[model samples]
Target: MEIPTELSSYIRVLKLASTPSWEEFSQVAKIAGAGILLVGMIGFLIFAIMSFIPGA
Candidate 1:
């Protein structure tokens, strides 16, 4: 795409977007944190199981 078109598109997006409220931000943060924790726990569990196996 051309530079002018790309810039206009970015400007349009910026005009349409608004800052999230505290409640919305907090909810997203909580969900993202939970996801991270869940993935970490799953990885740890896999590592632990592998360590106990005879040959992994």
Candidate 2:
């Protein structure tokens, strides 16, 4: 008996999703936090610069 191609692919996806590794999750979380911090710093700088400008 042979398995169909579609069935094999589905099984492969299920096997991959069955495990949730903590190391990978933490790496993703750290990158996301750094990105948020960078965006916040940029916004603060823009606000400070605008405050010093003359009236429009």
Candidate 3:
């Protein structure tokens, strides 16, 4: 008897879902909100400079 080449044994991975603990949730959310605010401020500063261009 001969075994097929594709029949080799392999480890299988399992997928699982999880809910974040309270500390994990709050830390992640606050960091994300802070990032958005920081980006917005930087964008506003860049736009503010457009009004002062010498050619404009």
Candidate closest to the true structure, highest lDDT: 1
In candidate 3, how many Å is residue 1 off? 30
N/CA/C clash count, model 3: 0
- Number of clashes recorded per candidate: 0, 0, 0
Between candidates 1 and 3, name the one with more favorable lDDT.
1
Q: Which candidate gets the maximum TM-score versus the true structure?
A: 1
Tens-digit per-residue lDDT, 1-56, candidate 1:
69999999999999999999999999999999999999999999999999999889
Estimate the lDDT of model 1: 0.98
lDDT of 3 at 20: 86
- Which pairs clash (backbone N, Cα, C closer than 3 Å) in model 3? none
lDDT of 1 at 8: 97
For all predicted structures, in order, the TM-scores are 0.93, 0.63, 0.64
The local distance difference test score of model 3 is 0.76
Q: Any runs in candidate 3 off by more than 4 Å, and if so which?
A: 1-15
Give candidate 3's error at residue 31 in angstroms.
0.6
lDDT of each: 0.98, 0.88, 0.76
Full-model lDDT, candidate 2: 0.88
The better candidate by lDDT, 1 or 2, is 1
